[model samples]
Target chain A: MGPVELGDQQMVAIQTRNLSRTFDEVVAVDDLDLEVHTGEVYGFLGPNGAGKSTTINMLLGFVPPSDGSGTVLGHDIATESLALRRRTGVLPEDFGVYDRLTARKHVEFAIETKAADDDPEVLLERVGLADAIDRKAGGFSKGMAQRLALAMALAGDPDLLLLDEPSTGLDPNGAREMRSIIRQEVDRGATVFFSSHILGQVEAICDRVGVLREGRLVAEDTIEGLRSEFDSAARLIVTIDEPTDDIVTAVRSTAGVVDVRIEEADIVVSLERDDRKAPVINAIEDAGGTITDITSADPSLEDLFAALTTDGDGTDLGVSSRNRSPGRPRATEGDA
Target chain B: MTWLHVAKKDFHDAGRSRLLWVLTALLVLLVAGVAAIPYVLAAATNDPTPTFESGLTFLFSPIGFLIPIIGLAVGYRSIVGERESGSIRFLLGLPNSREDVLLGKVVGRTGVVTVPIVIGFAVGGVVIAALYQGFDGLDYLGLLLFTVVMGLVYVAIAVGISASVSTRGKALGLVITVYAVVDWFWTFIPMSLYWILERSFPGFEDLPAWYLLLERLSPGQALSAISLTLIDTFGAGDVDLTAAGRVAGDVPFYLETWFAWVIVLGWIVVPLAVGYLRFRSALLN
Candidate 1:
């Protein structure tokens, strides 16, 4: 209706409201609303075939949305996609490199495409591919190719980065290195939006995480916030030199102790509150049970992910934060 | 700017391919062998002067077929191969629009297909000057430029098919069909069908005029007609007009030798425009 402005003052780096895409009869992404802030490393977590790549494709304007609208850096995803792409660096999922080009040439081509003057050698060195600069990518291993892709994505210091399944072909050590590079990118004032199925990888670096299931955003929060939102009950396992009935009774009588089990050498107590652990240890010692080891297992983000994504009749025991609305049938969040 | 980068990269990549080198060698050898034919004939007949008409005869036939094959070799795999390999993601991840990608492929592949043809023509020009005593440099240049234009038309057609089709195999099939229909069967099959049908009906005395137009509509036929019109190297005896060519003399302006150039221009532009429209909205997988 009006002349579109180039500079969007919206604080969000990526914001999509009711964005949707469908193929024939199958809905790949459905009525999805997502908000990712500037300078934040946002982790989009979803299982395989949960429409992660479809959403990214729509956001980047590679696949047009069947319905709704969205924007990246204040530019419409459908209209100003070229402007959006100009400022964003992307490592697309299931993408390949030019096998004829060497690793350094790939980075140089990216730099040329972006019209930037960054040194290709420095970029390759950052991605740990300096030794393979002159070698053609046709002979590269999967990890080497992935690293070259990453180097290309990071060439021009773009304002936003979209990396879909960035760790798909990396070893554990390589994954760690990739995570550190992501952290550095975030520190450079660029918002990083990456998709991953591994909860541990997301937990290590994501400032905020969104859980996607069957094309819907079930939960969106920080890692600690999500852990509390799903289920905060911590497992306090105390290993003793010998098991005693008095110690078991003392632990069971402690306040906020939901469940207590005595295995051969340990007293496992499930506590509703973390502060209740002090009284359980005191009670075990007061009953002449000598403690040898104590391990407190808090409810992890993995547990939260499983609780949010798993679909059933919604009757999982001891998961209290499953209290969200049931308006969307696909997203069974807070019903644990 | 991004399109140029893409074109440069594509040109460099296609140049380094072993298949292109092999094709170049074959084209050069074929051109050299074809160029020496007039010289051999002149020696056998004891004629010191080989006319330019003899020089243009065999050169046009083999090159008429060879240009389409070289164009197919370069352009058939430009876009569909990238789409299949998923490198299109890398290309689009940059600042380029879909038009840039398609146009870059057209230009880059045109360079790949045209370079060897130019080299072959240059080598053939050297041999022609040495063999044909009455060889006109201007006429030779016109023939060389016309051949290059025909080569570009086929390249556009091949690249157009590459962009319009969804799979590499489909692109391959479509380009091969284009070559077969336009070069090999455009004149023969339609004329044969017309004669067979006329014999049954007993109403049509001669082949229909539109059939002649259809034959001339092909890029190969248009190039042949346009080259003869542009440079009159062929003597009356050397020029054996087909049925269409004989009828072409009395037809309207649209069916004249000058109109073949228009067909050549259409051959270059129409397929590319259609392919560009189809490619603009194609969902990259």
Candidate 2:
């Protein structure tokens, strides 16, 4: 959705208008305009050095933007940063916890920092860290430390949560738990804006995903939307009683059918459009092959993400420009 | 309130460390040892009354060296260590500005370093009262408070270097250079300048009064000047009024003993002010 459309009805959790940050000659984030709506799980996907963290740091006001402006939770990021931080919960990338403090103490410190009245015990228990509550965090494993950090981020039940690489050190099981917690928070009417380099981590939870390439946002849409936009191939698999050359030839000759292959008990046909499935099934039946069952599978999000992130020459999108003006937002056509 | 929360957390973090505790214990022992000197002199000379000047001078000399070490040890990693280890981003992620972090650190570290000085002086004061014949309570309290201010001056310097440097190693090197030049080798500058001028002109006999004023900028020298002014039994009789009338028209205001308090206050404010200006704009990686 456009920022104008969302701004009319619902609040924007984060909106950056022509925000840019530069480090000497290199442009970290370039002429970026981003909008995230409230009460939605927005996935920020990018590779390393894709300006995801820089954009986040700018929104948090940890680093000043070289030009342009932005706002978080209705507060200006440049002029009213402390107000922005007061209502926002952030799990920053490469954030370190005090080694001497215990897990419980870290949560308590967060509670005090945010001026929240919630009990630290409940926050730690929610993150499944109650068993190690009193132990010093210096002895924690990477996964445990991540849990404590997440608990700290969840303090005060903030209106907006900005998690940068939230599952960086989590194992598969821990990552699943983290996702469930993120879902619970979103269900509770909180807006979650999290970034991850891995596509699989966000595909299940994100209501909308914005993919960043180099210093620019290349695409933003729902998972299903991205699939239809990029992936054009669908596969139809038919269980046949017997393999026949007649069936193979007949299926291959159907309209929109790209290729036909016969496995042990199934005959599979790749078609360019879903409407061609009936023709392929009729062709197979006319060839005297008895079909027991039929099923069709669309291209998954993994394929769409790979295709969108990779350029036509099979290289990762490496486009970054130093010539763009600071306060001018670039025009891109993809809706949220 | 955000700065107070941050400062309270920092105070607890530093106060609980075993290294700081060990350093404070050593300082307490050193103060007790200094306090025992008058008793030792009385025992050796078979006289029951030991002069007050000898006791105050011996105690003040070693403290001129120990207080800076304790202060630097407590404050050397206030800011740059956090940046190097990536915890600064975590601190900034909360509802805190960069000014809060720097100022909170100064307050937290100043409190941590003051604990040792206050304890050491308290122990030293007890020993002086029990042993020395003419120990004055009001003068000793004034000296003790001045010592705490002196320790805070070094804490400010250490925190300023911590805030300005990008790496902990670089901050350590710079703070140590500051300690070396200001605390240990401040008088060397004037002596070196006098030797060079004499070799060139052949009749540059006495050091300029302005050089003494320049040396007063060091926190250690400033503390010494204040201590001498408070004690009154030593360093008061050494000013040569007739010799002061020989070369210059009048002495600089900073050269006066009473003006050293201003120099101490400058040491506490200047470094942190300069550092906060740089830290406010520098990018964090």
Candidate 3:
């Protein structure tokens, strides 16, 4: 069900074994193993300072691991970094721009470095930067800088695109545009590996997600798989025709229903098992509230991410870690 | 084996600096403005032949001071500045290797310094030809070649320090220390060591061969040695540069004037080689 099960040489885009890095004495990345298949967008999810950037740096040969080995596009990350980088496009974290150079010059530098015959204008236009192509990067906003970096990463039509925190300084709309550009790159058969601290940023684009906490990977699965693993507390929203206090009571009284609330036209019910959905719907209908629309909130990745990333706290299987404020999105700053 | 793109981009980035224009203007003044002084003095004395040798002799001291400063200013931050600003991501993120970046920076900053020198020579060379009677193009070209080579050596040294250090402060401090020791006080180092080891001050005659070699070791000294030969070719007999004049009866081959070219090549290659080795092994954190 995962990329590792493919067991083919050409199927792997990135692979690492026992990868570890330590800064002085603090282990930044610990004994990690990962396999990302060709042509899949693997989202590396972690909280801030959870060694996500360190892992990415090691993969790109920017940081040599204290131990272990890895390969990108079958080229050893340590020994053959130049050859690996030739086929790989990297949008590095905390990257700065040459203030004196224009947006077009930035992209042209990439193309020239990679020896790729690409029109910088085309790449800039692809990133919605046509109007600012000639502008110097010193005047660019953070989001504008992020877009320019993406255009540079898209140079040479790389086989693998390693983007670390690709949505750092984007507003909601710009984030969506970035997602579409990532989609276009993936559609062209390039593998994408992007890191994000916020699950909301990557939920709509990632093919598979790996949750990293405290320098160790905690969970790895498809989005659906991660949801199902934590689906015992999935929120169920039943859109009813009429606002009814009785419907909440009825659903709460139903077997396997844990919590119930009525908000406007919807009866929100929490279920213990996936099978309890039918009983809750029947209870709502029997309470004289007509069920027009029903949607199981599918644990929504936020809950799963919370459950996976919560530290030594009340991490009971059926309990919702959403109560822990640590899992909430802190990077809501829309780029000014 | 420098990447042309990196070099080109470096030149373009540095070319935009107002300091570069100021340095260019300064060089033009030093070359043309300063070289015309000989013509003024010769005209006042009603001397019939104001030789090119006088202009080269006049230029030797000022060029030594100006060339190293221009080279250091252009190259001291070539690598460390990118690292400090976090823009090295764009450089190493591409296909270029760390070695290529260092070499390209040397090549690039060499271009940055050479352009101004070329412009200054073009303007000043014309003025000197019009002012002086014995204007030999070959001797003038020889001096120009030495100026460019000296520029290249200083750039290599600055870039080497840029690559070796992790912080901008360290790079600046190291470059300053190198410039002061190599350019300003190199003669004093050998002199001090001679005074210490020989139990007496070294006189102008019969100095140890090691002392002469050590004295000519710094980039500035080697450059001067080569320029002395170039100036001698002017045949004006303005400055006596032959080693036998100061040394004992016979000079060792290593102290020969032409051996200074080997020292110049060493200054260019050694700093770059040392810088590349350090830069290649470093983790760009």
Best by DockQ: 1
Greater DockQ among 1 and 2 belongs to 1
Residues A150-169, model 3: lDDT tens digits = 99999999999999899989
Best by lDDT: 3
Global lDDT scores for all candidate models:
0.79, 0.78, 0.83
Model 1: per-residue Cα lDDT over A1-336, one tens digit each: 211333564368888889998888898888999988888999998777778899999988789999989888888999988888888898988887788888888888889989889999999899889899989998999898888899989978988999999998899998998999999998898999999877878898998999887788888899878767435456677899998888888888888887887767977787888788899999999999999988765544555666566653222322322333211123322322
Q: Give me the TM-scores of chain B across the candidates.
A: 0.87, 0.87, 0.92
- Error at B217, model 2, angstroms: 2.0
Error of 2 at A138 (Å): 1.3
Model 2 chain A: weakest 10-residue lDDT segment is A314-323
Model 1 per-residue lDDT tens digits across residues B83-134 = 8888888888888888888888888888887778778777877777777767
lDDT by residue for model 2 (A1-336), tens:
222236379778888888898898899888888889888999998777778899998888778999888878888888888887777788888877788888888888789989999899899999889899998888888788889889988998988899999998899999999999999999888999999877889989999999886678888888878766533456678898997998999889889987787768877777777788999999989999898988665544554454355443222111111123222332222311
Q: Write the per-residue lDDT of candidate 2 for residues B1-285, one digit (tens) a residue.
A: 588877887887788788667867876777778868777978999977775556766777677777798788778898988898777877888888888888889888888877877787788777777777788767677667766777788888898888888888988898899988887788777666756766542222244676566556678777777776666665445554222332255666667766888888788889888888888876776
Candidate 2 stretches with Cα past 4 Å from truth are A1-7, A231-298, A313-336, B192-209, B229-252
* Stretches > 4 Å off in candidate 1: A1-10, A231-298, A312-336, B44-49, B188-209, B229-245, B248-251
DockQ for all candidate structures vs. native: 0.59, 0.59, 0.58
Instruction: Record all residue pairs in model 1 with backbone atoms less than 3 Å apart, i.e. clashing.
Output: A322-A334, A322-A335, A323-A334
C-alpha RMSD over true interface residues, each candidate: 1.0, 1.1, 1.2
Give fnat, all candidates: 0.68, 0.66, 0.80
